[model samples]
Target: MKKKITLTGKILLGLLLGFLFGIALKQLPSGYIKDTVLLNGVLKILGSGFTSAIKMMVVPLVFVSLICGTASMGDIKKLGRIGGKTMLFYLGTTAIAVITALFLGSILKPGAGLDMSNMVSGEVTIGESKSLVDIILNIIPSNPIQSLANGEMLQVIFFALLTGIALNLVGKNAEPIKVIFESANELCMKMVNIIMLFAPYGVFGLVSSTFATVGSDAIIVLLKYILIVLLGMIIHVTVVYGGLFKLFTKQSIKPFLNKFTRVAAVTFSTASSNASVPVSLEIMEELGVGKTTRSFTIPMGATINMDGTAIMQGVAVLFIAQIYGVDLGINDMITIILTATLASIGTAGVPGVGMIMLSMVLTSVGLPLEGIGLIMGVERIIDMFRTTVNVMGDNIATLIVSNSENDLNLDLYNSKPLKKVA
Candidate 1:
């Protein structure tokens, strides 16, 4: 009899092969083969297609699953409590992330010995960020259909919640809609499984193309900065998340960690928190979170919970400050923590978003915005790890909220979750 490999095994295999292939391509001399053929041709198609598939599914999944989950809550107050706890947990973890990054950045001194003469002349235009009032106003969509069409995640979420509340208030009149949403949710899951079948190749294309273009030489040059950020991410995930898991459930973290390994690969490969939702929800369900909690929290977490991005920005601010030999006072550090925590909420959970938020943090502390260009070369690679941490944070928030609400199934958490084979 032949043995089947789990999704984690497949993703790891794809990641390894992609890394080797990309590294090999980098060794080749500059030509059409390296530039137009592989980079622009095959890899682009696969990576783009993979991303498109996830995005295409997000609207339907978030809309349907959330509606079903919200209506099932049976009380409007429950929704508010869940939302409150989820956001509070998200904000708390984000603060911890920034603190960890700052501590590590100070200790590692990623920018102390850095040579900036090669690219110090670079300049970047920092866009005017919206005010808090404006961000809040924008959440109420003018047209829910148009918001859904534009992929306005926050607006869609807001509208969905209102609709769900209305359905809950109306009771039996909403049963038909609830029934439809439940069926749609199942359909979305089926689509996710179908999408996973192509995940290996998609990841291979995405990772290989990214490493090939970034090149090993550039990555090696930024090794210090890379290591510092990764170390902070590791500490935040294990210590902060592990602590949260222990405090809320008093259960071992091993099972959740095991299930999340596969989803982390999705976040890393896709470099988008939105793209990781299906897998995150699946993993949470397998690890014992009820559908009501999973549906409401997972989508909301991806939209507003950006702990990993916060860590990158928090550390980047210090790194850029160090590169320019600027000294930061206690006030500057406090400003960075506040700005980064807020920025994570408004920031889009997508690839390259950390850089944009980093600009906000730097500008808040009067650091050089142009300093971003120094690390932009290797940002894509670092983003993969940062995103991995973000996905884990989302699940951790879900677990904590569920466990507290008694929405967790301890039996399922105690038993191993079944794995699907390709």
Candidate 2:
């Protein structure tokens, strides 16, 4: 009898193979084969195409799923409670994540002996920081159609929640609209299923192109910084997230991690939290998270719950400070924690968001923003690991919320083989 490899297995294999292939491609002299054919031609098309396909599903998936989730809750108060819990978990975990990163960065001293003289600094662009009032108002969506078109996730989430609530309140009269949303939700999920079928090839392309393009000299110079950021991510996952899971759900962390392996692979490759939203929801469903909970929590978490980005920002702040010989006091660290936590909510779920959030934190505490230019060398690589952490945080939040509301199906969660997609 022949054994069948699951999608997770195939995706992991693709990731490994892609990394190795990228390393190999790096060895080739700069030429048409390395720069044009393999790097730009095959890898670029497959990876970009795959990522575009995944992104194509995000707006619709988030919109339809949230409506289905909110409307299905059947109680406005319960929806509010779930919303409160989700926000608390996201923001609280993010604060803890930054603190953990700062602690490790301080103790490990990843930047103590860093020599910044020879390193090349890239031009760093920082966006204008929004006030709290502005951010709050922006969530209301002045024009929902524009929000959806522009992919303004927070605004879209706001509109979807309102629509779902109205649909639920209208009772029988809303049944037709509700049914339309349900069908649209199913169709969006089906699109996810189809796109996922090409995940392995996509993973290969994205990983290979990244490694091929990156300069190894920079990676070697920043080895300690790289290791520290990775270490912070690992610790955040094991201690903060894992500890919280055991504390709240009273279940071992193994099952959830096991189920999330596929999502982690995609997130690490794509390096975009929003791009992984549809897949995260699918895996959460397989883990027996109620449609209502996963639908609302997964998309919202992807947009706001940025524990991984917080970790990077925390460590980067310390690294940059040490590089610039700036001594940060307790007050600075506290400000970073608060600023990063808030920035996580405001930041979009896209690639390179960590750097933007880091800039804000640095500005808050009088750290030189030029430090961002120094760390740009290894940012892309670190982004992959941090993205994996980000989506995992999203899934865990979904599971905890679902379990608390009696929306978790233990039998499905513990089943030997995951339920198959139809």
Candidate 3:
């Protein structure tokens, strides 16, 4: 019989087992195990290794896939159209996400009961904001090689777009370059497959460490804040995405949600949309997105589509405001929504990006930077859920856009799954 298990299933099992073990350790007095190598060394290594492996693939996969995507466009005007539409959709959804989050958070008042005196102040300082000119200038890297080396995603995207456009301009001469990039893209995906085989172990370590460190008590302490964030995420995924699908494609949400279940599970378990890109792209294709739409939209969305991050930023701002006993004016609320939406695009999609963007949101509203500390302990755990929602939002946007552009193939979408990566 063929192997029945999938990478996603294996990762889910890992997460489940790891959480069980962590809870057991927490409940039972496993002082010896805690003091011994399991807690300090083995667990940390596994978690770090998984993250490092994912990060290792990010720069190469993005650069190659982006080059492939852009070059495959064949027409620069098509690239411009797709780019414009994708950005508009992403930015619009981000704005909607933050607004919904702010609205829900205000109604719920998640921070009202929290005691501010006991909460620890965050030590990390917010960075200085750049002017629009500076932000634009920074997009063109002085050294493209250095940008990739440093994993500067925006700069890398900029460079890749330019290269792809230049290649398109070269006409037949670009064939060899396109071939090389396509091959590299295939190789990088293979690398992702190889890395994913170790996913069970990696997830076990990461989730175990995360739960052990955060403990259930922290969840109790921050229950209100957590619930509000989660509620906002659910609203965005179910309501906003659902509405978009109905409005654009006139399709039932059932099929989309069914297809999304698997991708969302992987995204939640791994907590990195960049890491989840291969799976998301695969699922999007399976859900009827054409090669062109999937290639262009999914990768770009992985880079900048951040509904989850935006919602978190908004809720976090409200949580902080409530904790500080500050009443935010209407202007303040609008400012938060705009700031979070823009920051979602501007911020890199690496780990801790939500926190960094939260700082930006707080800074825009004159909220205390120190307020971040209150939530840092739980940020890692929260990030997993937020990112799952982020990936889901991206896929939904891609589907809607594909349908709008008449690029989706409903027959292919309803077909059986693709052959699993060997």
- Candidate number of the best lDDT: 2
Clashes of each: 0, 0, 0
Candidate 3 local lDDT, 257-355, one digit each (tens)? 777766765566567888777767767767778766777787788878899989888888999899999999999998988777777776676667787
C-alpha RMSD by candidate, in order = 2.0, 2.0, 2.6
Candidate 1's C-alpha lDDT? 0.86
Q: What 10-residue stretch in candidate 3 is worst by lDDT?
A: 124-133
TM-score of 3: 0.93
Residues 113-209 of candidate 2 have per-residue lDDT tens digits of 8788877466677676766577788899888999999989999999999999999998889999999999999999888998999999999999998
Badly placed stretches (over 4 Å) of model 3 are 1-3, 28-32, 121-133, 417-422
Number of colliding residue pairs in model 1: 0
Model 1 per-residue lDDT tens digits across residues 1-422: 57777667888898889989988887888888788989899998888898889888988888887888898999788989999999899998998899888888888788897788864544766566665567788889999999999988889899988888889999998899888888989999999889888888899999999878785666777788888888888888878989888988898988888788889889989999989989998988888899889999999888888888888887788888988999888898898898888878776677887887888788888877789888888889888988888888889889989999899998988896466554
TM-score, every prediction: 0.95, 0.96, 0.93
User: Between prediction 2 and prediction 3, which has the larger lDDT?
Assistant: 2
